[model samples]
Target: MTEGLPMAVPAQGLPPRVRIHEVGARDGLQNEKAVVPTEVKAEFIHRLAHAGLTTIEATSFVRPEWVPQLADAERLFPMLADLGGAPDIELPVLVPNGRGLDRAIALGARRIAVFGSATESFAKANLNRTVDESLAMFEPVVARARDDRMWVRGYLSMCFGDPWEGPVPIHQVVRVAKALRDMGCDELSLGDTIGVATPGHVQTLLAELNEEGVPTDVLAVHFHDTYGQALANTLAALQHGVTTVDASAGGLGGCPYAKSATGNLATEDLVWMLDGLGIETGVDLGRLVATSGWLAERLGRPSPSRTVRALSHKE
Candidate 1:
């Protein structure tokens, strides 16, 4: 739906236009050691929108004690209300529970995301609740958000592997994913939180979801680059008909709850592949690369994205 962007006609299986859900502002900065200033975070979102990102996750409404980095969610959303000169973008904020949802709604957030885990250990560790309890908490949040005419996204983490529990079964992943979908989530993002998923794992999980009557159109893939297979796993998902892919600009985040998790798949890296394959994403690779570089300076390190490094060198 981005202006001037070509649509991928589902040629061999891949969607013509892949929707890149930019999670840099929320997911990317949440794991940083030094809290990025609120103004810098707002500017980062604006720049990403200017670079043609139609859906930019602005911030999370989680408790400040839980994620101190994104504590300014209320302040951040107001700054994004007027995107300066960028395209009209959907800014989604993460809400951990009914309380978080209340805060997001108070800020006039039209879109929000709720996170759940497939494995019990992670559910307990990250959320301090069992998987069922976590889903129970999200049920009301999702229902209330829908009542408010807001979009709700559900994130299922550790779909392939869990640090506390190794090698999660596909059926378990499907069970959790289905629960989220049944709860009326507009979309469900399957996350490889530990980044241990390979292409084969991706294909198998997607296939099982499809077999279970969960449409790929309602699913998104969020991968971490820890094992260096994020992009490869993403390509496999695309071949399986997934059109939404989540990435962080500059590869700026890791899972605090998942000890071994690394930064997410970089937006610039994904855009480079989509551009080369002639898959329309509406992102300007050059501008995305620059945006990553700009954020990297604030993070006090160079971007880990291979594409960002390669493009920066060329420039």
Candidate 2:
């Protein structure tokens, strides 16, 4: 395929623009089997910002032993301190607990995310705590973040399905999402960690969240493409008025704790769809593809993004 833009065809009732929460530096890299060098990771984030991804998730403040790939969070965050212009780019970091929150706050992190789970299995596997226990742990963290006047994002994983458990109920997801929103999260990224969600499931969950007083304005959708449903699920969320969508640069990352999970929705692919639909993301497609290509080269693997494959000639 040629290195070109997609045809513009506007979609009805969709938002004029979408805020892509780029997660390649954090979520994508953390799942890597090998530890990526800190210098290289910093360069990747810089490239992502240069590619016009305004809100890039810089790194996770989780314990080093828990996610070895992102062990250089302290060293990496400073490298991106000057990654912007007119509208300074937003760099959000993930914090697993109060200790993690302390680490981030010390680094002058203005935005932080607290990760939770919709199911007991994922909560136990990822956080080593029960669902209620994890929420209790996050309460203090979220409260502290809010007190500091920082933007807090709540990531509720396994919203659609859990590998250990089967299909997840919508009400169960809503219960957890409501709890997170009620706990003072500025935004909530509903995660389909195992990628078992369909469009119908996505819409149903969003509706349930709305009914439970979790408005669509503060909602984001994070979908994995394990069963080729991420894009479809994202479109469903868009139709339901969700504007913030989380995606990895090149379909990079899966749940480190869930074996059945696959890569996230590719930023390039998402941009391609939004571009074709005449929706604005402010991302330069060619530049974004090249950035993913550069990261793919450093990792010694081709990008999983179809748009990247079609637009970039790998060496």
Candidate 3:
């Protein structure tokens, strides 16, 4: 088990350790217009693991036509098979359905994730099905994955607000989350797909979920920085007993289905804040910054992480 800092009571009752689920390799690069080379993707994941990120989301098994950038998932998984030898490290692939799950299982993947949407508009636009239909699609996938003893995660997008549907109600978000949880997902990540969530909104949604008997132990938060509220909302979730957060390296991802959405919270930025609070994440800040800087060259732009920019003198 990863040891955290000595427990210090904060006024907000936050946990001493926070698990930063690194999503840069998959989520961050998925929306990029240019295709990143498969070898580069492998190197990036290796660097992230070296930076002390234990749970790195490596690639998605979606159809190439949908996400051409990650079309090399099959090629990339084999390159990462060596890293899985470390008991502390996990490389999870995003599997859209049973076919995607089959591709991952054939490559020896032990962890996989399924995605759903909270709002009807996003559900239809992204998955080409209604919210219930998407959940139905995930049921068999999650069941088969668990039967194989592979860890399964379910993601609920647009939990706070939606672009086409306007403000999403707390009840609606809870309903989808409950269904995902009941489907045998080991964890459920609530996403601010368009990044319109505020601290108050996060608190309200979490509180309601808690009332509905969804324990925080099985929950994670995935926030986007579109409105500059990602960190603040994360702090709110932490205070509410959420210990897992999903962040991208260098603040690299945006939802392609939501044009108005911006990048996801940067792992470097999240680490900086958690370090300041004396919360342990077992990640090396300096090395994480360097990794982002290295990726920036391939991306042809400076990293969006303020911590990386500040430390690199790019400010």
Candidate 1 global TM-score = 0.95
lDDT of 2 by residue, 1-315 (tens): 343788898989999999999998899999999999999998998888889889999999989899989888899988887873326699989999989998998998999999999999889888999999999999999999999899999999989899988999888999888899999999999999989999998998899888888899999999999999999999999999999999999999998899988899999999999999889999999999999999999999999999999887543
Give candidate 2 misplaced runs (Cα > 4 Å). Answer: 1-3, 84-86, 313-315
**Alpha-carbon deviation at 63 in model 2, angstroms:** 0.9
Candidate numbers, best TM-score first, in rank order: 2, 3, 1
Taken over the whole model, the C-alpha lDDT of each candidate is 0.90, 0.91, 0.93
> For candidate 3, lDDT tens digit of each residue in 92-129?
99999999999999999999999999999999999999
Task: List the pairs of residues colliding in candidate 2.
Answer: none
TM-scores for all predictions:
0.95, 0.97, 0.96
Worst lDDT 10-window in candidate 2: 79-88
Among these predictions, the greatest TM-score belongs to 2
Output the lDDT of residue 214, model 1: 94
RMSD of each: 3.5, 1.6, 3.3
Better structure of 1 and 3 per TM-score: 3
